[model samples]
Target: MNNYYQVSASYDDVGNILSITRRGLVPDANCFTPQEIDRMTLVYDTPSNRLLRVGDLAPTPYRPYGFKPGVSPSAEYVHDNNGNLTFDPHKGLMMQYNFLNLPTSIGAMSLTYDATGRKWKKDGEFGEVEYDNGVEYRDGVLEAIYAPDGRLVAEYPSGGNRSEGDISRFVAEYWHQDHLGNTRLAFADFNEDSFIEIKDNPSTGENELEITQESHYYPFGMGHMGHGMLLLLQRIGTCSMVLKEMKTWG
Candidate 1:
């Protein structure tokens, strides 16, 4: 029998989601008793239609940098005069933006854009990525090359010391996307075998595909935890580009 979950949402007059409730089947029970798995309440600025709070958190006024401390420090969303989000409590830092409203820095990571406002470089604690054309270089090493359709076609071996002609270099990857163009699976021939392999996963006690990575997302693009391997190629620059494209085409 297939188990299923039901998600219901309550929306305001302007179509803003006020609350979302997820109900699922009770474990080890034959009877159909819906058990609540998750619930979230969203609060918004009515006039501006901006999301102010999520869950049971109270909406607090925006605070600028160097503001005096009050009785308590609560999670608050801060926006600049141009309505650009400058701070998010979840990130725990004030984001700096350029004149074009493009984010320049967030915490330890810093970004640089070209003359046309296209992001060309990202330097962070993990590593640095330089975007040139459709290719990405990580710390002065060829990391990956993307297709015009935004599909990652190839990736090079890790480590900055490896050369382009190295025997362990250049792995081809294929992506399988859903109807909404969400990437669901990424597979590659790592062993150079003629066939893609499948093996038993000891952790989950299930047969798993030996693929590079796989991901499942919620309706709003939030990824599900513990469902697949870590996506090594996912980066903030790519996410920002995708979001910008979505906003433009939506």
Candidate 2:
């Protein structure tokens, strides 16, 4: 590979051991997706320990601001040594954490943390700045959320905004993950206990952007959607994932 990365694996039948090794660092291919890591040569000793490693590879130094960002190539983001966001490309101070290093607020949407550092409350924010901490966990429950950029996108409950809301009158987000525990689908609970989805109007076979809404994509963002569609198969809900999958092409 151009980055001087190589992957080699060996399986020992006698000991039932499998070993894998890598040469160089492989940066996160995409921002929102789960990262692929090759940090250590895993040696799974099923019955015996016959797996052997011959070489060593040290990872390159980490330079957060200096290294190429996974999402935005035009601007850089800043984080503390603990990986808490202090500066975002568009929204500054993505998440403000307490002394314990737990998030207290995501942008203007205030959050309350329990004694154990668990977020228990979230307040709405209607500021001009858009913020998403790439996670939405509150009141000891995780939610259906993901952030391709620095902003959050998820299904909203009644009175909750599609873009921002801290409080929820909804259930904890549920997920179905791949074999590697990669979440590929996020289902959201909307108003009246009904689900959130984009459907074609019966009168007109047009994909209404949830009524009076439209989304636009640039050339670069579109490129990923083209290829990501195959990977974004129908993974949830009736009349949901199938339609949303086609939306990528539209």
Candidate 3:
């Protein structure tokens, strides 16, 4: 028998509505697990359509799991004269600055273009740099990825190293083992070209330098808020190394 049911109703109390319940089912030989039970609730500000406080027997002291109902800290937004959403140096996204925001580093902006020619979000220093007329695009794709000063950091698939497809093309079992496993992250040179190499240990949250047969040590660049400098180093058909190891005292 499909044993599943919910009980709910409303009552008036101090200009609000209250709900109560008690539910369970007798177990059988095939299914011996005890039935779940949940009770006590309340609703307030009925006229305005709101649940202010719930209780015990009926519903008392309503407490939202993550947060109670209330107005959060106020935040201001920035917009250009055309009313386009702009990034404020103070408030980045979600009404707060990300941990990566550094005072020394010049704030950079990233603009995303949809299929249409319409300008979407213009963030950070992108607002500062005037768009050059020579910027190229092909088949709705930006042909040139440039720096703030208009220098070509990378071209399309052939020039700069930017893979736009599913990352599974590079990583094996990308999503499966995220814990202490043999699978680690490394920046593939693709053609064995000496560009930049990076590797990290998911278990220790540490990033380690991956070395080559020629004994070339590629430094691991740690962005802001990196957990630890430790790294998980591994070479296929070979051994691996760890950065900083933590030892237990007691």
Which candidate achieves the best lDDT against the true structure? Answer: 1
Q: Write the per-residue lDDT of candidate 1 for residues 63-174, one digit (tens) a residue.
A: 2111212333446677887788887765467799999889999878999997689989999997998999878888876678877333444443456345456425566777
**Candidate 2 global lDDT:** 0.42
TM-score of 3: 0.21
Instruction: Give all candidates' CA lDDT scores.
Output: 0.62, 0.42, 0.34
Model 1 clash count equals 0
Report the lDDT of model 3 for residue 2.
33
Per-residue alpha-carbon lDDT of candidate 2 for residues 52-151, written as tens digits (9 for 90 to 100): 2321222333222112223442344556666666666533347777888877777767766667766546676532222234455433334435444122
Pairs of residues clashing in candidate 2? none
Evaluated at residue 232, the lDDT of candidate 3 is 36
Q: Tell me which residue pairs clash in candidate 1.
A: none
TM-score preference between candidates 2 and 3, better one: 2
In lDDT terms, how accurate is model 1?
0.62
List model 3 lDDT by residue over 85-171, tens digit each. 343322243222223231212235445444444344444642322233444333333444433322232233445444444112321
- The TM-score that candidate 1 achieves is 0.66
Better of 2 and 3 by lDDT: 2
